[model samples]
Target: MKEIAQSENIEQFSLKNYIYIDKTEYIYNLIKKYDRVFFSRPRRFGKSLTINTIGTLFEKGVEPYFKGTWIYDKWTQNTCPVLHLSFLKFSVSDLDNFKRDFCNEILKFAKTNNITDFTDDKEPKVLIGNIFSAMPEDMHIVLLIDEYDCQLTANINNKELYEKFRLFIREFYAVLKGEKHIRFMALTGVTRLKDVSIFSVGSDIKDLSYDHAYSQMIGFTREEIKKFYIDYLKLGISYEKHIKTDCVTDNDIEEFLDRMAEHYDSYCFDEIYENKVFSTYSVNCFLQSISQNQRVIFGDYWYEAGGIPSILKNYMESHEIEIDKFQTSEISINYDDFMNPTSLPYMNENVLMCQTGYLTLKSEIKPPRRIKLGSANREVKAALNSLLSQKFFNPDALDSFYDADSILEKGSVEEIIEHLNKVLATIPYDKYPVENESILRALLLMYLSGLRCDVRSEQHNFKGSSDLLVNFKTRRVIIELKFSKDGKDTDTLLKAAQEQIRRREYGIEKLGDRELLQIAAVFDGSPNMRKITEFKQIG
Candidate 1:
């Protein structure tokens, strides 16, 4: 396959010459039902572009950009005046500056329409009133606000400051309900602050964040990928010359699709099973990386663009949440949590995760229902692992655990035990308090996670549940753990654990022409004086 170079300007903002995704149909349908709408999505999920598209669609003449798009023939003949305000173009730090920035946007739009009635000195609400009153009654204003919650969300650390900004925004947008000349209005933000004054306005605003009708509005669908970028993908996959197959078949293409889906797809905004969409930002990054270097690299494009929001990092640290808890997929959260305009006084982890796009809606019932949460994709999982490792675990300790994993794959019990002890020694005193048999198992699971192993905790069998089972490429490692509050006979506990694994025949079914490595870990003493007592293995 001949290599094709993708545009390096994928990250640049330009509505012209853009790969116009078919969202016009959705927008047309949306405007017909709701005059005021609030759409919330994660940052860089193409909210800005969508806003621009709406604005351009209402322009006087059908621009060349919409020549062949869905809206070309279906759009209204008379274009209306568009008043677009972007919160990102301001250097706002406080409520005053935020108001000033909004007023500036109003003044700029007024100048565009040849109306000189607005001033920067006026309050945001007064300026909004002046602009709306000055517009011709025949030319209804198309109001579009992008990054509407930027000021409040950016200052989430300052409770008083966030509240002030939220109040100002609410009061400013409160005019939307009574504005008579406005034809349509849409607001976009990273999160919805339901309790905030803005959304409490009497306007009947529809939230499209989790609505199934617009699930694919922000991201690329699988079929869209194959239709738009088949050539680019073919060239990109050919660069993976390391695949051991003699000749690539149709299965290889499917495998490539699976790989992309694992890293970037599976973002479900709605409870519906078929509503998932890939992150458009990550997809472009992936294609751009592969095209530029001719190699597949799933580097931290989204996470690195902007690391986990500082608000989330502080929350996690304050709560002292273990990193492994992210793997727990059955967390429950209320649907209203994401709609509130103000930050919750005491936010739930699942709610925070879902709103910030780390966890997405997995399944749900209708009204008064609890929604299930799970990781958005492997890209997010890898980002969390990187963040957790850097924040909690020492580099040397992680290295030792990884080295121990390699040794356990083929080495004897004594060799693996020595390496694992080194890893355990790196645990600080603070981590000691959380130490227990479960923590030990979690530690092993975390270490094994670095490798491409299929690890299961509390794996069930005929006898009982095994503590941990790690299936490597060629071998199976079955581990059981026991804990003691005092420095007692942990040796016997280790022996008993090994015997339990043997009795259950944990690895017998899949041990054909491969090795079954059984190991036992025993912890002794209380939290104040705790350490691993002994490590045993059954060959």
Candidate 2:
């Protein structure tokens, strides 16, 4: 019944009654295995908490805070001086301010540890070197750097500024390369920038980004969720008005988890693709919502909590990124290519998108080893579609597009078609020319994704693939699309589409307990003037 805490600080876990999913076992093993580690994951994946945990272990010695954690008894009670630096804490608006602020932070760390006789140099590299030189030979410090690539990611759009910051941070990190006083070092960031000295200079630092063992280090595994969140899940089920009973069944609990997984799970980080963890922050937010509202609402917690990452937003605005391609088609990249350091301005958009959490590792390919990436989950897919719709549709059109949700729930074929046509009319024809069936399907899928329902395209069954399938609370709509460039008879095209759906038996296996509504839609006119000519329920 206690509130779930959202603080990034590990010390606050107990103070704030936070349900801390114990990943200390994994973290303890990581510390024992690697002396230097560089971990790159998308934002809000708990990189800061991971950093704070490491800092807590080394600097504060696991005690009252980590009583129930795995590392509490395993770790020695000996504490060491820690230099914890988070780039997020610094002002990165300009070069001088960044340098001065970072230098002051280093000085503050040095002063905390009682290291003296350091120069007041504005250069971060000089300050770090001074601290290293000033430290006693017997005392080795633990270094945990959080958001190491923050400045670079923030200035990615500005090539000149980005390069300057990159060079400076590279030099600053390079100081730690061969420093004997550094007992252990860990750097966490959203990206692994190319030419950073920390990776290339001295002894190799292990990158655990793609390591299978550490994939679930920062996120909530299914087992963890089942063990930790069962009470909240049961409470949510109890509050459901439709259940109408005090006793909850196992199927009820599992069905709730299934919905949660659909919206929040399936973020794969390793090459093996065996371990998929739910978004940690999103899971917490969902549980918090259930606790506060006493009702279960599977909302877009991750995307809603942190809107499009700034780096991704800037990349999208500046680059010619085909937003539809990523969602509509299969995407794969070589393992080596994906792991390699990405440079700015000329960075691979797909790689960047994967790094920023827009896409996640879907599966692994052998022979010529590669990784397939796709939308992490339903929440991400819907968020991406909503973003795409905003880019292509005006305010009025967006309102009309969202209104389709209510129209869809009513199961009115005519109303749904009218709303779809209104949304379609607002598409910028100059940029997105609907020339063929595939384009029309993609556009329709984009709009349908915005609706508060489960929308999927090219859903394959035994017979064939359905163009689009939408699942409402009680109804399943199977849509078959047909398009003609020449002035073909709309009625004929509509009938053909209907026959294809019936002949193929699309979504027949999926009609478990819900009412099925099969519709055939035909689009007529040229690329610029394409509009839905007819839509009819294929009863």
Candidate 3:
């Protein structure tokens, strides 16, 4: 922790300290194998850092900067001309301004490399060609572009503007189609447009976004955490008031890792699903915060760091995306279709969510190129729930929502029922249509997820499934919901729900010495009334 300072400049920090893990061998192998590579990952997932690392390696050979890295002894190639471009701060509001600025950026890079055979051309495509032509014939150049799709994603809502920009980008990138002097090239972005010229043209760029070999290249793996940040983990545990310092054991550290994984880990990018990594940005932020404050705190650091991508926020608002559907059921889509989206304007909401990091692959690649997607982790789920609740429900009313952790720990069944009723009353009538028990369960799950508890829907056992289950510390609440649009009485519905929970033996095996609370709730699903009518404890 002392070696790592809080700095936004990752390049400088990485070069100066041992805090950064070395992945030079992996990247070097990729460069040696592929001439052109395209990668896609969510925002703030170290794409920029990866680009910079490659740029530095090619521009300055691994003498002083990468002295002890894996590639130091094996980098046999001489340093060559490197052209690095980053679109993270590009202004794309106007086409004319964008063109002028883009050309200037290329010219700036060209001038730094002492390639001065450039005409005063405003066209970016011409400037790029001139730069390439001016380079020495024997020396091949390495090109690294970060956030290549930033312009298109920014203007996705404006169809006319987006099309115009897309045409310009396609033509501009088409200049690299037959560049024989390119030693290696790589482009990284949040989404990979299917028909874009960068992929559709003659350029043989391999998309390594879902390649299992590189899935753990950017993010921090669990083993990496244990190897690099074990001291910080112990520090966090020491800061925990409930854990005594003298009695700290290996089990305490394992439990702390589990809690941290719930909030920040479990992001599966590839189909294999064998290796899941935590968001690098989120893990760094958490460690930095705890180090500064001397306390253990788990927050939505990733979501809070970048809020939500404007593209995703706009898409969710414009489309009638059923947020509950993703929570209630497994969302499976073709792997090819999900990876190579045709266009951003008409892209599927699930694809957009997956690209933007709200959702991630939940299962391995199944038959027929199908994969299941869900919320990346608990932090992501809580962030989405908070966003939707703020958008639809009254903010002030949300403050009145029960303290979920406290109530689940010590409150009685009647208190839990009252909490559920209060939470349901905040939902607007038209926003949520309680048509069936599943819908009701999904809605409750969505709202309850925002609290500090492990809330799940459709908990299955050997016999059947329970509607909802909420676990907080030492207490677990298993809820069975019954919805009735016809003329079914609350008493009958409650009895049926209780019978189902008992007959299914829900929570019997899972309840290992912890106190369990079973609830039976009946909701009135009529058009005029969509609230939980009555609820009581079944066991």
Among the numbered candidates, top TM-score falls to: 2
lDDT of candidate 2 over 250-362, digit per residue (tens): 88888878888989998888767788989888888888888798788888877788777778777766777665577655587776567665575667777887787778887
Best by lDDT: 2
Each candidate: what lDDT? 0.69, 0.80, 0.77
Ranked by TM-score, the better of candidates 1 and 2 is 2
Candidate 3 — worst ten consecutive residues by lDDT sum? 1-10
**Candidate 1 total steric clashes:** 6
lDDT of 3 by residue, 499-539 (tens): 88888877776677778888888888776666777787865
Per-residue lDDT tens digits for candidate 1, residues 122-240, read 58788778777776767588899898877765665667877777777777767676688888888898777665655554546777777788888877888877666665566666778
- Model 3 scores what on Cα lDDT? 0.77
Score every model by TM-score: 0.82, 0.93, 0.89
TM-score of 3: 0.89
Off by over 4 Å in 3: 1-10, 14-18, 241-252, 365-367, 388-432, 460-465, 473-476, 501-517
Q: Which ten residues in a row have the lowest lDDT in candidate 1?
A: 4-13
Query: Candidate 2's error at 37, in angstroms?
Result: 0.5
TM-score-based ranking, best first?
A: 2, 3, 1
What lDDT does model 1 reach? 0.69
Candidate 2 lDDT score relative to the true structure: 0.80
What does each candidate score in C-alpha RMSD?
Answer: 4.4, 2.5, 3.2
